[model samples]
Target: MHKDRIWNKWLFKVIGLELVKCCAEFAASVDFKRDYLKILLSDYLPESDPLKKWFNEGLKIGLEKVAFILNNDNQLVKISDIIIDEVGLLTRNIIPNQYIKEFVCTNYSLPGITEQNVLQIFPGSEKLKHYGAKTLSQSDLKKISSVRPFSF
Candidate 1:
């Protein structure tokens, strides 16, 4: 039992570190997508249109500032902090507890379990294998939530 506990501790630590790395990469990918979309839209706007031109210039400057921050060795940490705070601000609201319970029921939350059977299946797998899990971005979740009755 002691050996098993030690192994579980080691497993959890490794899993936690990998999850953190995956989350960071996911956040970076999201930032890249946002910048890429802004740049592409800026290019599509006609230069002759004064309003669009102004918007384009602003977008370009914003992109350059982001690049500068990302390129600097010392700014990476600060940028990470900013990203975390901005995400928190952008997504301050969480799914309400009542809505979550309803969603879990309506969406096949765990595929084969339910509130009624939860107790029975609570410890079905004591020694679980790590087959990996899919990672979704906030936008992806938003798209999914839009399709559903609830919004995350």
Candidate 2:
């Protein structure tokens, strides 16, 4: 696991890479429509990646268009939404929950949603295999919430 390379471990940052990998394996099973991909590009891609941005954006647009079809907001309160929302939290690599939680606290209340539920919301690391290598652990969880997500 590239534990050192990972900044926090939020999965959204790496979703694009993972989706690309899946395009090769289960081309039909996934939900990326060419149109949706284009929309994703114009909306989600950062302006700074330069060449990579160009390549990835073009590819996604084509991939979406090639499918000849495509399809596809947030007052995230609660750690679950926070975890899922801040997934961009790991843009380059893993993101620490500490960084993410602050955002969550701002929008959502902690009274209802708990950490265990939040962890459940976290997509498995399996989907994130492409971005650096890393395994999740209890200590890593600490990087997220000083205490457990469900420490009620």
Candidate 3:
């Protein structure tokens, strides 16, 4: 049982690191497809894993950001609707609580991230309560006021 716990922790860590790398690369590229992340995640995790739920939530948030960046408010709304529908509003709210808490507790070191700058990179706890798990942050929300295509 102890060994299993250790293995699971290691697995989550590996998956988390890979997901972050993939998300960054996908976000920066012009050719990113919305389903590409789903496919990649499915390859790494089983369908019923709770971690998959959290990762998918992150993917949805990223997609919303992309839609906002492309000036497609309609698509953003659709994405948000899909999230609320798939997870239900309540579960959607709870999902982010565990997700963000685990993320911070794991102490996954990102480049240039430190105690001093962590809040700047990721919103502080108080700010997180405002954004919750459903959205990214205020700046992200502001950017999404308009939406556009994925074209560079």
Candidate 4:
């Protein structure tokens, strides 16, 4: 019926707009947590704090994941890739979000990619199909601090 088509179109537009808003919100949250962790580790925390190491490593992993996502030219990333379900990487010193804490704590090793694997995970392949870099550059990182999440 004509009414049905009109209603469906309206619903679809509303849902699409909501999905975009949700994606933006999710990206902002990721950036916020990364920034918060950096400030806590570098400024507020003392050198002697036993939890510093764990926090530092966790932050490193998080940043690496961000690099991986951006380097791949992805609009959205999977939570499973970012958050592992391991048991030792996390520390109680400064617990991050519930999911992130569990992801780090349970994973046996830090997420890593070898030189060969880097070509596949990020840009800069031998074929020159993508950008010429193995990881997110300083400029890319600086852009993350800006209002726009994606500058590349």
Candidate 5:
């Protein structure tokens, strides 16, 4: 049991690090910037606009579910909220860099928010919190990962 606990801790740390790295790479990509612009435009623009239609129709990505077992309670919890929180933090850190800012501005013309007002814009966690993180039993975790092969 003690060995299992130590292994789980190590595993979660490695997974978390890999997740952060993947997010960083995705955040730096042109596709991410385009998707960001689409979201912004879709939210703020008139419903009838063609760009809004394009955003609604063209950019839906399926959610990837990740679950973690809590050490204290031994309850499984979906960690999407934690990932969302971390992504917000990463975005905040990345956007301030002059090179990234220049690249975004040079490539895209955002509505309302521009290069001059860019510093003021940040992704809000409240918007990302569509659902509260859910706690699950070990059995529930098994059922979820059963469809896909479960791995350590």
Candidate 6:
């Protein structure tokens, strides 16, 4: 039951290239054969493209922060080129993890205003209201850490 394996091709391709190099390096321990070629084509291709580099880097950051839940050497995460190509218009390529989480939660909490440029141009619109942008004062944001448990 493989449900549309997206990154497997790239992974296999990578694996094949390594195997080829490995066999060449240690020819005594390995033999090149037609059956191996079948496994090579089926399992891996050398020039497979990967997800976007920036997004991959971002995932690497997260994996590091969380005690290396994943192998950073392997691009386990999938970032489509379509999305990468659409960066800046739809998203920034170099956002940090805190910014990413904040973006997700803030947007999910208010569908009207999540990274949309509604607030910059149209200040007090309904979308801005949903985002609570008006209420979020510079002072309040700056002093969020200093505010007491029940302080006003």
Off by over 4 Å in 1: 1-4, 30-152
lDDT of 3 by residue, 44-112 (tens): 244376555444555444443432211122122112221111222123343333343333333332222
Q: What lDDT tens digits, residue by residue, belong to model 6 across residues 1-152?
A: 23236565445434434543332233223353212212212211122334333223333332223221011222122111001111232233233324433443453343233332211222112222321223323343334324322222
Q: Model 1 reaches what TM-score against the true structure? A: 0.22
- Where is the poorest 10-residue window by lDDT in model 1? 120-129
Model 2: residues with Cα > 4 Å off, grouped in runs: 1-100, 103-127, 133-137, 144-151
Most accurate candidate by lDDT: 2
- Model 2 C-alpha lDDT per residue in residues 13-107, reported as the tens digit of each score: 34544444444333333454222222223333554534444445554433333322111121212112212322333332345555445434543
Query: The CA-based lDDT of model 1 is what?
Result: 0.32
Residue-level lDDT tens digits of model 5 in 45-126 = 2436444433333222111243321212322223232222233322355233343333333333322322222222234323
TM-score of 4: 0.21
Question: Model 3: runs farther than 4 Å from truth?
Answer: 1-8, 33-36, 39-152
Q: Tell me the RMSD of model 4 versus the true structure.
A: 21.0
Which pairs of residues collide in model 6?
12-44, 13-44, 13-45
- Candidate with the greatest TM-score versus the true structure: 3
Residue 44 accuracy (lDDT) in model 1: 24
What's the lDDT for residue 38 in model 2? 26
Residue 46 local lDDT, model 4: 38
RMSD to the hidden true structure, all candidates: 22.5, 15.1, 16.4, 21.0, 24.1, 18.8
Cα deviation at 114, candidate 2, in Å, is 15
Tens-digit lDDT string for candidate 4 (18-88): 43334334445765422221221222123253343333444334433343322123333422233221222
Model 5 residue 124 lDDT score: 30
Predictions in order: lDDT: 0.32, 0.35, 0.34, 0.31, 0.33, 0.28
On the 0 to 100 scale, the lDDT of residue 71 in model 1 is 18
